[model samples]
Target chain A: MRRAFSRRRKPWFAIAVTVAFFGMLYLPIVVVALFSLNSQKSLTVFKGFSLRWYRAFFADHDLIGSLGFSLRISAVAMIGSIVLGVALALGIVRSRGKLGSAAGLVLLIPLITPEIVTGVASAMLFKGVGLPLSSGTVMLAEVTFSISYVTVILRSRVAALNPEVEEAAMDLGCSRFQAVRLVTLPALLPAILASAILIFAMVFDDFVLAYFTTGVTPQPLPVRIYSAIRFGVQPTINAVGTLMLIGSIALIGLALLVPRLFGRRESLSQLL
Target chain B: MSETSAVRLDGITKSFGSSVAVDDVTLDIRPGEFFAMLGPSGCGKTTSLRMIAGFADPDSGSVLLGGEDVTYLPPNKRNVNTVFQSYAVFEHLSVADNVAFGLKRRGVPRDERRERVGRMLDLVQLTGMANRRPRTLSGGQRQRVALARALVNRPKVLLLDEPLAALDLKLRRQMQVELKQIQREVGVTFVFVTHDQDEALTMSDRLAVMNGGRVAQVGTPEDVYERPADAFVAGFIGTSNVMTGTYADGRLTLPGGVSLPVPSRLGLAAGSRVGAAVRPEKIWLSDFEDGMVQIRGTLRETVYSGATTTYLVEIAPGVQLSVLEQNIDRSRREERWTGGEIIDLAWKPEHCLLLCETA
Candidate 1:
């Protein structure tokens, strides 16, 4: 009885580890968020509350331009990756041959390769192709890296869909393409929207790939923050970090809720 | 009344790689008729239905719908609908939207679509469930939604691939009657494919019995049930006591030296192999009359199934016959015939069916 009770709650040792783990995880982020609202510009000391850091962060033209560029890149990457990923998933599911299964496994390589390695490799590929690094390069790199995530999330969903639904569409009066457009797409709407939200959130705050692929005139928010922090941390950077963190949380919540709104049996987090 | 063929299959054959799914099938379904394709699993009944729906193409011959050959046409081009075995109602759409799907695809106007969808909902007895999601509906209601959705367009024929197979027993029985009534009211030809013999016998205006990708027989329910064409048809349609015997001069000689007289001149020579098939309920006991052949047998077992008692009586050393008796006058537990009791059985000569194909 005592062991069962201990199992339900945790041993004192485990409880201490849980507290310490979470404390270590959230302490730095909490400090940044707390300092973002401080009147004084001290990392260790929390002064009286003020929104001056947020005001400065909004007033900085270069940082604001970088933020806007990041949003555009993330949005384009989200849309581009979703289109290519959904097409690849459908092909993998329908292609019944040896080459298909091999390609399916090979596609998962991007998910396992280190993010730094992928960033460097993508930069070298652009250099080899004689293409100038810019926001387009960052967007392209983000889309290529995120396709695996989208395909991984949507493969099972495509399989779970009933094939008869499409047939019913065609029997009703839809051409083959129209059947896919009307029936198949609507059935997959919730999953597609959830994946889109997730992909957008991932690409928005992504740092390593953006650092390697972006041009010098303007940078994505994360790359800009990293460069700014190397010189000296500013309270405005904290303000920007807090805003990005909030956006990511909101996007994650939207991803988890979209499927539920459609009354689907799956949650997108489960796919992740 | 004038009659016309609604759907016709001429020498249709389909093969999947090396396996023949449907072989040399030729059949005609009449307009406004409830035609059922009854067969066991893997017997090409569903394949035949798919061919008609244009989801599958026959390797040879042609499919004619209302005298128009639609052999190579896709399902979208054909004016037909199918109710799949799984019901396959769209979970993403509401009941009304699911019914309006086909009509909407045909570029139907909004108000007309609403009116037709409403009338269809009323027909399927789901008038108040227009806004409900298909996932919330019960199994029976989902089936009704599938029916309503497919039937809203009023296609030339509604091909049902065991649509009631997903329902429970009581719901299946109730839906069988309702489906026949709907087929009559709509006056649309229904090509229903099912494996249940009782369902086929009850609801179909005419049914085709298929076996191993081939049509065994095509006739009215009574025609097939009362006069089966071959051994497969006789056993498939319903239960029959099929036994091998040698026929000589209008008499079948049994193993126990018992001779049963049959109707004369079935065009077979003497000493030919034949099967004497009889329904269990056709054999009579206790009440004896002229023009009936009576036999003596020892009862081996009696199955009391509430409404009727089946007595398995062995007339010879190895020849056994089952006799079904209603528990009408003898409903008490003690009044039923017991095993090991000597019984006298009588059946008319016409009641004893003689098939040239022995089992």
Candidate 2:
């Protein structure tokens, strides 16, 4: 009788823990989505569903321009991060002795240091150099921080790889560069792609560094949303937020699916 | 194609801090002969192989390939290939692409590259799995892919760093035979590194035994096994029943006051101490006989291993000796020797080898 009671309660205990964990994470997002569909322009009370706020957000040219600017900046930053990150990871991993350890610590500085410190210091440096603070500066800041993350991820992946593959390639009549390009790069492609997706998402969602570095004329989406929230609790803001949340979710899902589909050949190669 | 040394190492030495990994040593590998460097771990066999591959530069000494000084040449410039222990297959490419990588980089025409890759895949018996990934293949299949990738370039020499170390017992045994056949078929000078005595003995035309960063012995497997130069080589090559004794007048005096006739080739001076090594199968066991050099010992254990029955006999205080006998039939006479029974152990003069005792 005791064993039957315990077994019946075990699944309930598992379900309770899972539901509690997800509720703590996504309950706020669900509330925001509900408010976005409410007819009344108030967050505290629920109202009947309406599409007026969604239509208003779509028609707003300024908001759309800000979103476009954010996308463009993130795209550039992600590209820059991936290139610099991969190079740095390779250099550090190949270095020997004390030099390698020193290189590793240098790459880790941006990853471990406070983000605000990096942001303010970079802003000051750019100002001192007499460079105009613009969306480009924001992209530069985001790239600086995101590249460190990319290096850390890619370095671990590269370190885990067997050096014998590169030796085998060179023995096969490939030059050093060709060996790296043909063997090393392909082995690291999945990790590089994964880092790029992560960096893109990070740069897209970043606000503190962008706020300090962005110019006056062209605020990024985060900055626009911040200012709009400070002014008033408009239903259109909720509509914009809901659309962005949905779009980001879809993009992350696509980023995850692409590697599985295209990387099948790569997985096969690894088997060989 | 020219008449030159295939691969040569002159006074090569490598050190990490104060500890020397590869002591100053020189060797030459002939064209199309399988040479094996056999040693235990930390004996610098792998280090020597790495220096030849240009992955690690020697602290001193020069490396030559085809009589050209390639000591400072990068690995890419050398006409040599290696089949690594891990097989090192690129995880992101198909087996065909991995095998074709070298040919592709040489700017071979695409059609020619495809033909060569297909031939190599066939050579390694991985033709049907060209499009399959390495992870999907068995350990032996991956090893063959690695072999195909290295062999496709038709290098002057091939270096294998314990290539069969990862396989299970059955696969490793099968691969041992296959590797020997493949090396002969390719007709390329092969330099293999391994610690397994059976592997070195079965696969190599000549085996170089290394110990403590030094070449202990280099000879044919039979020469090394039958006539080991030192105590380490004697103990390492195969199982041996060893006893230390003093030599005088073509006779060896054991600890128990038993003097046995020595082999004629061991020209040791009288009163000089030496270690005698005799194979287990060579030792004869029988009931005690008068007027014969013999040692009395008790049979401690008997193990019947289908082909042979091995008896563990205690020859002296704290000293155990192993005796092996061919199992011709399950006769009562053979089964009569049980544990705790006294037995006499003896061997012929020619069966024992005199080895140098290391200081």
Candidate 3:
């Protein structure tokens, strides 16, 4: 009787826990979205629905330029992270014994250290080197932190791969580069693509690093949003937040969907 | 493609840290011959195969392919392919694409790659499944696809590292037969690695038994089985009842004063310690007669297998010997040598193999 009662109640308990977890994550986002559509400019009380804030935000050239600047930096940073990450991952995986373990620990240090520390140290290093503080410097700083995450993720994927596959390709008359391009790279593509997307999202939302690295001319979207929030909350800000949330959701959705579509191809190859 | 040795390993030695994985070992794999390196785990059979394939470099040896020194060449330059134990099928491509991967890397024309991949798929009996994913297939199907992927390149030598170890008993038996047929059809030098004695004996034309990071013996299955070079080979290759003894005047005297005739060509001096190896099937149970040395003992246990019956006979206070007999109907019931029954065990003179005692 006890087992039967517990089994019957288990699914309800699981449902309650799942709902609570997701509710905690999405409820605030939903409230912000609702307030963005409210007629009143203040968030404390809601009036009739209005698209006035949306129209005003779309007309704001400064917000548009900031968003564009953020996109460009994230794009560059993602590519930089992938290139540096793949090389670091391969090097760490290829090293042998104690040296390999030591290299792995060194790579993981950047990932575990505080992002503020990384930002401050990188900013100071650029200043010391006499390089101008620009969007490029911002990209460089964010990439320094983002690449470690990419490398740590990709290294595990590369290490889990069977070494025999690459060897078999080489044994079949492929050069080392050819084998890697044909076999190893294909096996690692899913993880590499996923890591790139993750790095891009991280760079896009980053504020502290951009704050320490940005120049006087062009600022990233997060820095712009931070300045706007400090002045006093406005409905235009909520309007901008809603749009950014939608963009993030769309980007994340693509990240999830693209893998599913490409993953189907992988399953087909295994069939052969 | 020439009628010469396809691969050769001269004095190959590979070490990992302080442990020598592959000691100085040399072997020549003839073209189109199916050879097997047979040993238990960590005996360096896989390491030696990997060295020949160029996946691993020997510490002090040369690897040759068709008379060309390929010791320093990477695996990509070698004329060999491997079917891994895991099958290692590309998870993100169609069956045809996976098979065409090596060809595409070699810059084969798209049309020619498709044609070759199709032919190879048919050869491995996986033609209709070209568009399906590997995960959707059974283990046997995935294995065939891996074979097609490797064979499509038409490499000079194909290496198989325990390719059938993952299958169930029935499937493994089926694959063993299929693998032998495939090797014959492809006419490639097949270098197979396995730890199962039955697998090596059944599939290989010539087999090398490895032990302690060294080649204990290399010969045809019958040669190695009938005349093992050492105690390790004798004990590893088949079921053998071993007894410590001394060889004198072409005879082996066991610890219990029982004497058995051995071949005179062993060339062992009198009183020299040796090991006498006799297969269980060679021993017979009967009453003792003149000119025949026998060990009188009571039967301790009997095991009735489908084809043969094994008996555990206690020859003395502590020594026990195993004997196998064919399961004839009359012998199965009438000659039921139950526990505690006194029996005399005997064997022919030539059946005993005198081996050097191992430290």
Reference interface contacts recovered per candidate: 0.90, 0.90, 0.82
Question: What CAPRI class is candidate 2?
Answer: medium
What DockQ does each listed candidate score? 0.73, 0.67, 0.62
Which candidate leads the pack in DockQ? 1
Q: After superposition, how far is residue A76 of candidate 1 from its true place, in Å?
A: 0.8
Candidate 3 chain B, run of 10 with poorest lDDT = B329-338
Candidate 2 wrongly placed segments (more than 4 Å)? A1-28, A34-52, A102-114, A262-272, B1-4, B248-250, B263-272, B286-296, B330-333
Accuracy of chain B in candidate 3 (TM-score) = 0.93
**What TM-score would every model get versus the actual structure?**
0.93, 0.89, 0.90
- The CA lDDT at A143 in model 3 is 75
lDDT of 3 by residue, A211-235 (tens): 8899866889889988888999778
**lDDT by candidate, in order shown:** 0.89, 0.83, 0.83
Q: Best to worst by TM-score, what's the order? A: 1, 3, 2
Candidate 2 C-alpha lDDT tens digits along B258-337: 66676634456778887778888877776434544466789999988878888888775555779898886643245587
lDDT of 3 by residue, B96-116 (tens): 888887888788999999899
Q: Is candidate 1 or candidate 3 better by DockQ?
A: 1
**For candidate 2 chain B, which ten residues in a row score worst on lDDT?**
B286-295
Off by over 4 Å in 3: A1-28, A97-99, A262-272, B1-3, B264-267, B286-294
User: Please, what are the lDDT tens digits per residue for candidate 1 over residues B1-359?
Assistant: 26657999999999998999999999999998999999999889999999999999999989999989999999999989999888888887899999999999889999999999999999999989999998899999999999999999999999999999989999999999999989989998999999999999999999999999999999999999999988888888888877567799988887777778875665789988787888888888766789898889999988889888888998877889988888887434435565788878999888878875786
Q: Evaluated with lDDT, which candidate comes out highest?
A: 1
Clashing pairs for model 2 are A268-B133, A269-B93, A270-B91, A271-B133, A271-B134, A271-B135, A272-B133, A272-B134
